[model samples]
Target: MRTLRRSRSRPWPLGEPTSPDGQISTVDLLLVRAALHAGATPGQAVTALHDRGGVLDTTARRIAAGEDLPALALDPACPGGPLVRALAVAEVAGAAAGPVLDGLVDGVVRAAELDRLVRTRSAQARLVARMLTTLPVVGAVGIAVFDTGARTFLTGPGGLVLVVVAGLLVVVASWWMRHLVASVGRAVRDVDPLVVAMRRIGRPAPGSVGVPPTPGEGLPTVEALELLAVSLAAGMPLVEAMGLVARLGPPAVRGQLRRAADGLRAGLPPFEAFPEGLAEAADVIDISRRWGAPAVASLRLLADDLGRRAAAASEAAAEQLSVRLVFPTTLLLVPAFGLLVVVPLVVSAFSGFRLGP
Candidate 1:
C-alpha cells in the first residue's frame, strides 16, 4: 500500500480534513479503500494504514492484534470512525470489497462537495445580513447628528411608536430571512444520496410494470440495487442474488425484500419479484441479462448523475436565496428605516418654525 509522506511539523494533509477532528483524513480512507480493492482484508488494510500513523495508529494496532474491524466499528468508544462504519455496513451485506470500497470513496467525495456548497451559501447569507443591519445603524447616526428637530421627534409619542415599530420590523425581517436560508440548508442535509440515486433511476422500460416502492418503508433502494448489481456481476443467478442481498441488508428493508424473494422462489418473473418501485432496476437487470452488459456500470452512471443533480440543485437554491432577499428588504427593512430614521430627521429639521405665525 502507498503511504503519504509525513513531515515532522504537519503530519496530516495540507487541505481540509474530512472530519472536524484532525485525526483521520479522507486521504487515509482513500488509502484504505485502495488496499481493500487490492485484496486486503479489513484488518490488514487498517494495519497497513497504521504505518502512515497519526491518530490511526492506535485503531490500526488493535485490528492488527486480531480484533475484528467491523465489530470494533460498532462500538462507539472505538477509534474506528465513519470509514469503519461504512465497512461494517458492507460486511453485513456480504458485498464484494470492490464495489463497497468504491461506494465509500464516492460517498466521501459527495459529502465533501455538499459541505462546501452549504458553507458557501451560509457565508453569502451572513454577508447580506450584515449589510442589512448596517443600514438602520447608519441612518440613525446620520439623523441624530444632522437634524436639530431630531430631539423634538425623539421626545414625541408618534416618534416613539415609529422607533418601536421600526425596531420590530428589522428584527422580524432578519429572523425570517435567516430562518428561510437555514431551512434550505436543512433540506439539503436531509437529502439522502441513496434516495436521490433511486429517484433518478430511469423510468421503467416501455410495456413493463413493477409495484410502486413501499410507501413509508423508506428502504435503502440504491444499496439494494448496488448489491444486486454486484451479485449479478459475480455471476450469481438472479434468484440467489436477490436472496443474498435481502438476507444481509438492513433490518428495515429485510422483510420487504424477503417478500420479493419469496415471490421469486415461486417462479415469478423479475418484474414481479423485485420490490415495489424497482421497475427500472428490473429493466436494467433484464437488459444486462440479454446483452451481457454490466449492471454495476449502469449503477455507477446513476450515482454520477445523482451527484451532478444534487450539486446543481444546491447551487440553484443559493442563487434563489439572493433573489428572495429582495422581498424582506423592500417590504420590511426599507419601510422601517424610512419611518424611524428618515421621517424623524425630516420632521425635526422644521420643528422650530411655525408656518401659521
Candidate 2:
C-alpha cells in the first residue's frame, strides 16, 4: 500500500500562492482536469494550469520539475487539497482516465458546494461573535464615560458594588460564549465534507441524519462503499475494486478495507465480506450480482439524496447559532446594561432632585 503523508501545520513549502488559510480553489481542480483530458502528464497538467492563475499556479513549476506529486497533494499546506488527493490517488493507481475524470468532476462539485456552506456558516459565526463582544462593551463605555450624572454615581459605594457584579457577569459571559462557539468550530473541523457525503450512502434511510460518527472509526466502511461503487461502474470486478479502494483511499482507512478485500478473495459472501456499517452497500452489491440491477446508479442517487440532507443539516446548524447567542446576551449583557447605564443614570437623577431641594 502507498503511504499517505501526515498533514502538517507548518508554513506551506514550495511557496504555494494559496490563501493563508490553506483552502484549495475549485477552479484550479477544473483546470487540472482539462489539462489531463487533453493528454498532458500530471506534472504537465499542473504546469499548464499556471496561466489560469490561483493558489495552485505557484506549485506548477515544482510539480513539472519532478517534485513528488502525491507528496505535494498530501501536504496539508498544499493548496491542491482533497481534490488533488483524489487525482494523485487516481494517477498513482494507474486507473483508467474516464473513471478518474468522473471522480474528479464529482469531487469538485461536492467540494465546491460544501465550501460554500462552510464559508456561509463561518461568516455568520464571525458576525455573531463581533456583536456579542462589541455591543455590551460599547454600551457600558458610553454610559460610564459620556454621561456626567452617571460618572458621578460611578465614584460612590453603590458604583463599587455594581462594578463587582458586572465584572463577574462579563467574565462568565465571555467564557461561556467562547465555549459554545469553539464547540461549533470543532464539530465542523472534525469531519471531512467528502466523508460526510460518502457516509450518507450507507445510512439505512434518507434524512436520518445523526451525530457524526467519530473520526477514523466509520471512515473505512463508507469510503470503501463510495470507491467500490465508482469502480464497479467502471467495470472493475468486485474483489479487484475492493483491493484498489484499500490501496487508494486515505491511509487511515486502508487497513480495515484491506482485510475486507482479503475476505472477498477468500470466498466470503458479499455481506460477510464488509463491515456492519456497510450492510446496505453489501445488500446493493448482492442485488447486482443476482439480478444485474445497476448498483452504481442506485448508489449514486442515494449519495446525492443524502448529500442534500447533509447540506440542509449544516444550514440548520448555522441558523441555530443566532438562537444560541441569546443565552449570553440575556444573562450577561442585559444585566451589564442595567448596572453600567440604567442604574447609574437613575441614581444620578435621584441625587439631583435632592440637591435641588
Candidate 3:
C-alpha cells in the first residue's frame, strides 16, 4: 500500500493523482461539479478539488481512467450544494468565470456571516457599518488637503510657509473631523431605540417584509408602528395611521408602510394589508386578528423589543466612541493645537533673545 501510495504520489500523466482509499467525499464531487458548471477546465477543477482536501492522487487517476466513482458523490446534501447553486446561477447569468463566481460566492458567504454576527451583537455591527460608510469621505478629504499643500509648496518662499501652515491646519482639521465623524456615526448607528426595533423586526422569519435598516436610518418596525399606534389610539383611521407612520419612518420602511396603507385604503383588511415581505412576522398579524387586538399592538411589541436593543447598542457604541476619542484628542489634536498657538510665540522669544546676545 505504501509503495502504491508513493507511485501515486508521482505526478500523473494527465493531471494530479487522487488517493487510493476511495475516500472521495460527496462535497468534493459537488465542488468539482460546481467548478465545471462554472466553466473551469477539468484540470483546474481537479486542482481546486485537491486544494479543498476533497480527493487525492491515485483516486483522481482512477476517476480520470473512467473508473466508477461513487454515485453519492454529487448528492445535494453535500456541503458544496449551495456553491453549486451559485455556480449554476453564475453560468445562467453568463458570469461563470472563476473570479466572478468566486467573488459572488464569497460575498454571499460574507453576507450570511455578517447577518449572523449582526444579529448576535447588533450594536457592534451598526458601529462598524457606520465607520465603513464614512471612511471614503474621510480619505477623500485627506487626499485633497495633501494635494493642496503640495501645490502651495511648489509656488515660492511665502507660498512654502503658507503651505506648511495650511497643510498642518488641514491635517489637524482632518484628524478632528475623522474623530468627530467616527463618534457621531457610532452614536447614530448605535441608537438605542433603533437597534432594539431592528433586532425585533429584522429577525430571520418566513414572511418578514423588507430588508433590515441601514446604519443611519431610524429603527423601522418600532418607529413605524409606534407612530401608527399613537395615531390609531388618537382616533385616526387606519389609512391615516399608516400615512402618518410612512411620513415618520425611515425611507425604506416608509415606502413599505405607504404601500401597506394604500392597500388598506383600497379596502384590504388590517391583517391582509400587512406588507408582503413581512411574511415572517405573520404570527404577529395572526395574533392581532384572532385576539381582536389592535393591529398596531402586535407591531408595537416588536418595535419595543427593537427599541430596547437599539438602546443597548447605542450605549455600547457610545462607550466605545469615548474610548476611541481619547487617543486622537490627546495625542494628535492637543499637540497640533499647541503647535498652532505656541510655536510662533516661542519662535519670537528665541529671536528676541538672540538679538540681545
Model 3 error, position 247 (Å)? 6.1
Q: Write out the backbone clash pairs for model 2.
A: none
Model 3: worst 10 consecutive residues (lDDT sum): 1-10
TM-score of 1: 0.61
**Ranking under lDDT, best-scoring first?**
1, 2, 3
User: lDDT by residue for model 3 over 1-357, one digit each (tens)?
Assistant: 000001111111111111122223444545655877776754355445543443334334444555322221222222222233223223322333354333333333433343244334434433443453344335434433655442333354744464466456546645553544344334533443333444556553332234544432234454345445445555566677666555443433545666677777898765577665444344565676688776655655665555455545544544455355455445544454443333433443454454433
Tell me the spans in candidate 2 whose CA falls farther than 4 Å from its real position: 1-22, 50-62, 67-78, 102-129, 152-168, 171-225, 233-236, 251-277, 292-294, 350-357
How far in Å is the alpha carbon of 253 misplaced in model 1? 8.3
Candidate 2 lDDT, 1-357, residue by residue in tens: 001111112222211101133333455656766878888766667787765555566567667667866776544345544344455545555554445555545644664565466556656654766666566557767877888878777777888788788877777876666655544433432334334444555442222223333221212233445556666766777888777766555444454566668899999987898755456677878887799677876665554544455445545655566667689879787887778778888887787675433
Model 3 scores a TM of 0.33
User: Could you tell me the lDDT of residue 204 within candidate 2?
Assistant: 27
Top candidate by lDDT: 1
Compute the lDDT of residue 164 as modeled in candidate 2: 83
For every candidate structure, what is the RMSD over all alpha carbons to the true structure, in angstroms? 9.2, 8.0, 21.1
- For all candidates in order, the CA lDDT equals 0.58, 0.57, 0.43
Error of 2 at 124 (Å): 7.5
